[model samples]
Target chain A: MKYRHLVITDPAKLIFGTAPYPVKTRRGLHIGGGQVYSELNFTLPVMSINDQTLPEVYAHYRQITEGALERALQLNSKGVILEFETLLEMTKSPATGVEIVKIMNDICESFYQKHGLASEIRLTPNDLREFERPALQRTSRLLEPMFQLFEQGMLAGGDLLSIESTGGKEVSDEALMMCDIKAVLFSLAVLGVRDMQFLWEKIAALARQHGKIPAGDSACGFANTAMVLAEKKYIPTVFAALVRVISVVRSIVAMEQGAVGPDKDCAYEGPYLKAITGIPISMEGKTAACAHLSPVGNISSACADLWSNESVQNIKLLSGMAPVAYMEQLEYDVRLMNTALKKGAAYSRTLQQLLVESDVYTDAQALVLDPSNVIRISSALIQGDSYVANARNGALEFIEILEETLASGRMTLPEMELSYIPVLREELQSIPDSESDFIEMMLPLLDPSKFIPSEYGL
Target chain B: MNYILSKLLEAVEYGKVDQGSPYPPNLKGMDGAHELTQKALDAGIMPQEILETALIPAMGNVGRKFSENKIFVPQMLMSARAMGASMAHLKPFFASGKIKARGTFVIGTVKGDLHDIGKNLVAMMVEGAGWTIVDLGVDADAESFLEALSNNPGAVVGLSALLTTTMINMGEIVEKIKENAPGTVILVGGAPVSTDFCRKIGADFYSPDPRGAVEFLKQLAS
Candidate 1:
């Protein structure tokens, strides 16, 4: 069984811990194990200082820490996603960097006293990296000791520190990895905690940084480390941490290639296709692929390759940050289909024939008619049209049927499916422009009384 | 006699770039805007007539559809492609002064950000609405914007930023633009930016989608 972790932090003491259950609050809620466990009831007091300044923001940090700890304790959470605003609020006053560090340590000690629970504290390396913004890099360096003190407090108290590597363009993998490893080492040394989880790939280099695992032995080494920690009775508290670390590594690898499907292969499709094609291919799969390929800019090329390939099965296309890029490729495929059909190109008949032959309707019809796997069908229709036009035409007729059904609410999908199957089989058996005939035959049966609206009123 | 042009416009409005474009499948295998535009031109249709009668009306319909949420990004892109295909034939006429672009619109994503989806959409929509666009691309700064403004006096400037961190840069850029070119119209957008934020930054316009930006530009041009 998979277990989910939740962490909560204390502002005054700077200690963090995981809740055994979920938490709820008036401001926000954290759900754990299908129930609300705690509420983040603490509010940041309005600062008397400038709103934009980091110091002013940090002034409210104490309140935030207190609120976080209280909420976590209330929820009995095992882990928590740390909210940065609390720390930002604490730095507002004219407190020296040392003062801030002391306050953080105090917060951590408070957690030890109150709940005696170790916390999984999450932090984004991106956020830390952002503090090194070009304009602030020099000033931040000058103030490094203060930051280090604060870091020390966090390390000493945090049972788990989740770090994210992807921050900005300047945050390279090497840099993020170095930063994460250093932070983890600091946590281990200060807090006597060996459990560290990374949210992105930047932290994967830590084991290597410490010393390379023997060839083909990285996974074994990690597992051994967990076992060693567990034998020391850290397992009950740190297993979730180990899982998080593993998830980060897996997610990073997946991001590099796109999302891993249930098959562990990258999915190259999305959800919009369901609305367009009525097929439910996994959006999660395409998302995985996007996360994998987006950093490298291979999304367009991969899509082009998918479109041009004739023998490829499961022609799932990956996506990018910009939906426009995907749309651009879709547009290109559509244009190619149009050009082939109009010129009566040899491929056009192949496409049209495929559509007529196929059981599925047009990409549009498939999308509208079926929402579950529309994305797959829409992508398939595009690929099919690129390869063969008769198939494309058949797909178009399917779209027409979908539109007609949606517009008039006349025919049951099963009835439509029943009517469409034979025609499709006939067309497939013999390639022809069977769309017009199919549309004509279906028109009489679409007499409103023939179908009942589904629960969604579609 | 201009029924072909009307049909072409309708095709574009519905994102039918040509007979083969599978979007808006209701018109599948029928002549799309691409074919119809070329056909209209081949039959000696005037470039201005194609622009005014076919392209503009078609684009207007698409814009309306977009505002109504009847269509979305993919559909709008198809319409834009169809408009672009038709406009290609009219390019020479614009150069010869037989057709005129309403005005120049300079656009860019604000500094410290590499995101461009929002910027590109605005550029395409504004271009399709018959304005010339000078896209400065992503991670553009105040100096670049100011230079573009100087080069194209009276041109409207638009800024885009998708990140919360980068949105702050927009405030600085807007201030600089106002200092340098007080008369220049500044349009701001992106996920984090709200109308309230736009007002705070002193930008002239704020739009959530491409069509809103295009409409704002059209109103300014007219």
Candidate 2:
């Protein structure tokens, strides 16, 4: 059967926001860490298997993609939804895209033949160059066969086929408006190929006009107008292009208070339905966040949180998904903050106060405030805060607690049996003030036999 | 004497900026590369000896550690900082011909890409390896690379691209450099670059990490 409906959810908002879920995959390829092809909107390692034409290389690619698909299928009870961004990046180069499609087709055909099952594939094109004729031509040609295959697959499975475009470049006001209109038409046309659902995410007119606004008050006025328009449109996926936290807070508040338009009761139905329907939902915040946190979660918590959530839950749903020992890290910061609060340490006090004051604590407030919660909240805070600047102080406070925990035997080697000790040790040693002390503490914790001599790397 | 040089090397390797900087724990409050280089200078140690014997070897160790994954970006950055501190004292000597740099190497990220971590790493490693680096920061196009080459003829060129989209720009850059400055060796690297891609783009070299680029430049200089 073919999956229906396409829902877009923000992965970052889900994880870091009051609503958190378990994720399975701890790591994957990040965007812009290596040789990146910007036009394609993805990053790849300079020395990837794609560079080689050997059969073994092709096999490796097949194996990896198959593994990814298998995992996604097993983990997601609803149907597999593959991210097009990375795949798009890998296949954007004309030759590579052709090869990848050929390989995917061959795989699907083989699977279909073996199981007497129908194979339906959806292609989402997000990066369309502005006025770049060659790119447009290549993209169109590449999409044609895929669309045909999707139609055939849908017919075989009693399903429907669909295609969606993120719309091309934001050119002139006129051009952007035309692109939006064209996107709706194109989506409808694709839907017409089969009995499929068509969903169009439009860029607000105010956003288009905001691009023209000057650097100051003009921009603010444009932003306010964009919010009003977005709310009016009931745009499910709205990106507040505000720079400061105050602005984000204001926008969110505006959204909540009906300043933009009538406030709708927010529910988890969109994600829940998308998960059940087997249709892919694309959200701007989630994809944008993934791109921002490409290699690591150093600068963007909003993005990193979403990636962490999706990776965790999706991986858990997939078969043979390896358990991420690093999940315990989130607890580190929480525990440390607790310890500091108990000790009434100055550093801890500031962090604890921030946690108390910030909206971030709303969900975890009961658990964090509990006198005897078993979960290690310190590491989680540390890991989460590692990417966002606002979270750094909390992370630092957690580190302080970790240092004290190590110093006091009360932390006990028994509790260190978890996978996070080594990582925590490394992080501790990386600190300037307590490096030697942490190293000394860790050696004994690692091996009780040589607590004295081995503590100094003897 | 060897012990002092080793200590200086250690200082640089661990990022001991000076006596005052309390980083890397083991050498807290100890005299760092800055102090040691000055002391070595005052003691009548030859400037060349300081560079070749003390600073270069220290940076080499840092580069090796980086390649082996024993250290990461932040650590490598610290070592580079330490090396820079030491190099500051020796730069004027090199300028006056009392000392000599290996050679000049021009580097820049390809057009349409603004990311800089990879480019910065390559630039630092190449500079630390004793070559003069002409860094044309992020979003640099072919003309900038060509202009730098014109000023420093025969200098090796390196192009960095951290985006897949920009890799295509690298191909155009390689072609442009070849057309304008024939015989100039060009190296391309970044997360998405491979040896095969280097060949496809007509670049002379490709390395996954900064150390490999530094080693390649060393070979070219030799």
What C-alpha lDDT do the candidate models reach, one value each?
0.43, 0.41
* Residue ranges of candidate 2 with Cα displaced over 4 Å: A1-458, B1-4
True contacts kept of 1: 0.00
| Per-residue accuracy of model 2 over B1-222 as CA lDDT, tens digit each | 566677788899899989998777789989999998888888788888888898888888878866664554456677888888998999889989998888888998876665454677688888888888999976788899989999999889989886555777898889999999999999888866789989988999898767778888888777
Off-target runs (Cα >4 Å) in candidate 1 are A1-52, A60-63, A70-106, A114-118, A127-202, A205-458, B19-29
Candidate 2 accuracy as lDDT: 0.41
Candidate 2 CAPRI assessment class: incorrect
Superposed on all Cα atoms, model 2 deviates from the true structure by an RMSD in Å of: 19.8
